[model samples]
Target: MDSSSVCHAEHVPSCHAEQKRSIHTGWRADVWTASSLFLAKISLRPRIEVALSTLACMRVPVAFLLVLALPICKSFYCYISETLSTACMPVVVFVAPLCNAAALASLEALAKQPDISLGVISHFPQEQLPLHIRLRLAAHWQTASALNTAELLYAAEKMHTYFGKIDVLLSTNEHVQEALALIREKFGIAGMRPDVAHNFRDKARMKQRFFEHQIPCARFQRLTSRQAAYDFVEQVGFPIILKPLCGAGSVSTFFVDSYAQLEPALAQLNPSEWNVALAEEFISGAEHSLETVMHHGRAVWQSVSRYLPNALDVMQNAWIQWRIIVPNAAEQVAYSDIRHAGQAALSCLGLETGISHLEWFRRPDARFAISEVGARPPGAQILTLHSRAFDCNLYEEWIRLMVYDQFSVPTQRYACGVAFLRAQGYGVIKHITGLDEVMRECSALITDVQPPKLHATPTGTYEGDGFIIVRHEETAKVEQALEYIINTVRVTLG
Candidate 1:
């Protein structure tokens, strides 16, 4: 067996024995032993006293027999108490910086679940967490650096001294998924393993897996040298995409249209043996994202959304405000092809239980090509859009699926969309225009609004300064409202 293969308690006895063997010994082990002893002393004191009193009142032969039976009874008590302790409330550790908006949202959902024993591993101190979440936590371990694997493992170990075995260790941060997977392997937590996580984090490896499975995706190459980049372009021609082997969002991603554009992008990338980069033949067409929930290695539910002009275009043109639309009928018969392909791609990539955000393109020929997948929830208020569309709390839905292996399929009741508000030029915002007109025109359709602030620096991403979420039973109505907001409401910076 591979040393890194995950071993679960519910598996064969040998698997449980393997986990037992992997536990650290010496001082840390002593602390765990002491904790268990303390718990036992507090819980079994009354039972021990009752047993001693009964034994004292008995005759000599009966007393000897009772004494002989006492050891067996004590062992039974320990077994029952241990089982109850483990089965009562599941221990879940969420690892991420507390300052992230997405993390805070997820933390709130997890804390609201009364049956979970939640612990947190973060770079920020425990006090930074909201009072409600802090009160619900079983323990919180702050590391000097959350991304450092050594520090993360130490935090989990220290948490184990009080919580025993961690049922699940997770982080929504893409940068921390691989590190958390390694920690899960080290502790035998049943979740995504390192190899599966690597397939999600490394775009090069993910594209290779897609190829092996005959999954329809863009042509890609792992570039290790400048010559390799040149050779790939020679074979595939111009208009290629370049990005780090592992990255998130549109940061550091470059679109090269010609030879003149390639050198500057390469200089910024500095691709070499150690600093590997990925290049792909850019597929020009409509782009969309598919959100899927997997349970025991298969997708159970899915939702799809369309980008107004795609992420690259929004990044390239700073003046363009980004918008996303989640059609009410995303799971209908029309999207059957992409739905099947997306699920198959996830299975091939070995994602077990969690929500995944997958980006894909619809080519000019009307064929869908998978771009990349993240082994976490979709960011940029996409899930919030889903919740509005379904009229259910998707945040709690994610928590239930990840923590309890349960999913309640939500009914899609409305078509939802979000229009981002981005300023036209550089510098802090000085003036805003056309807001009163939008509210007057689409007040009935507008469900939530976050107007941009004055004198605040632009966020510089596709998700700009603020956003407005709108939903309606009719998809066209939602689409029309989004268009009106993007065109009418404008942010001006001087």
Candidate 2:
């Protein structure tokens, strides 16, 4: 691969074409870079005169001149709107566990955006990423631990060395949001602050905000000691949920149903001040996820997805195949209640600008309760569903929203759902059955399928080995297709 070019991951053999294009683009960038340095050191009159002269002499394109004026243009726009650029490419540092599928997808989206210099900070080496992704990055820094504050700060400094002025810091991983927020603060970057990020990252703090704002959420307490755990159990009674204060997904989460389960749960939790746990009342209701896009401290756009059964249930039952549905008319009047409540929750939690994934419940009595929310894009192909439903690229939308504060909201065009295929009696996948039948019946509806490889070990997560996505215009039809898939497909394990 050439040093200057980035081939799309899907198209690697044409690397030379990409490199040639990059080489041509470099002349404009060279002008931008050198002129920017001189403009910074000189006064306003000379800066403008020299910049204009240089551009005219080089016969720079009109677009290149506009790129030079991006800062002034953004200032005018922001001031008028009670707003927000540069010839120098804006530097954005994305932090995550690089090897994860979601991170790779998010990175690809960022790379596709024009004019911005992208840098990556992660726990894994740059080689962990696809060659195409590595070639696109202006720079990559590996930290001993992505979560460590000092290491992150050092990495940011190194990225700054390569690409001047770290303008925006972002991460889609829920596990590293707060750490990234802390780094953002240290660098004086304009984004979510640590205090606000804490409200979303720490469940205990999050629930406190909910209580203060009078938002209906599960009854929860921060277990500080053995006695506190016992007291919480006494208050909430049997069938409680125990989870890490800042856990992502269902990892390290426990569902205790009786007295006999309490001791084992407590033993596993090992609750203490340094390692506190959260115990909440087990909510018995239909679970759903709300994806909200917040701008200027308000909810601007939103979507919803329903879990066939909650994540915890799937985590407990390895044999269960998980499914998620994105209704065609998700924003209909039926979801009006959640829309109002979810927006309110985002406001109180201090989501200034970005996408948030909130988990909530609709009780048997037809009331809603906020379970938790992450100040980042959701996982498990939820965004993929939105892309199919709306006929737009949500990954690119999310990138633009975070990096440029712009969103071209897409209209919903279809309903979509995903069925996770988990093999029964897992050790390694030995056989897959019923796929042919599914294709014969639901060929037109199916959009994508990732089949498990023979002899592959189970992933041991709720998402299971592989998944199939189906899309349609009617919500009921999508649901029926998902049900049919779950009943038909079976992956036999050795």
User: Pick by TM-score: which candidate is best?
Assistant: 2
lDDT of 1 at 30: 40
User: Which ten-residue region of model 1 has the weakest summed lDDT?
Assistant: 3-12
- Tell me each candidate's TM-score: 0.81, 0.82
Judged by lDDT, which candidate is best?
1
Q: Where in model 2 is the C-alpha error above 4 Å?
A: 1-87
- Give Cα distance to truth, residue 438, candidate 2, Å: 1.8
What Cα-based lDDT does every candidate model obtain? 0.83, 0.81
In model 2, the Cα lDDT at residue 289 comes to 94
- Residue-level lDDT of model 1, residues 88-122, one tens digit each, is 78889999854676788889899899777787888
Candidate 1 error regions (>4 Å)? 1-87
Error of 1 at 263 (Å): 0.8
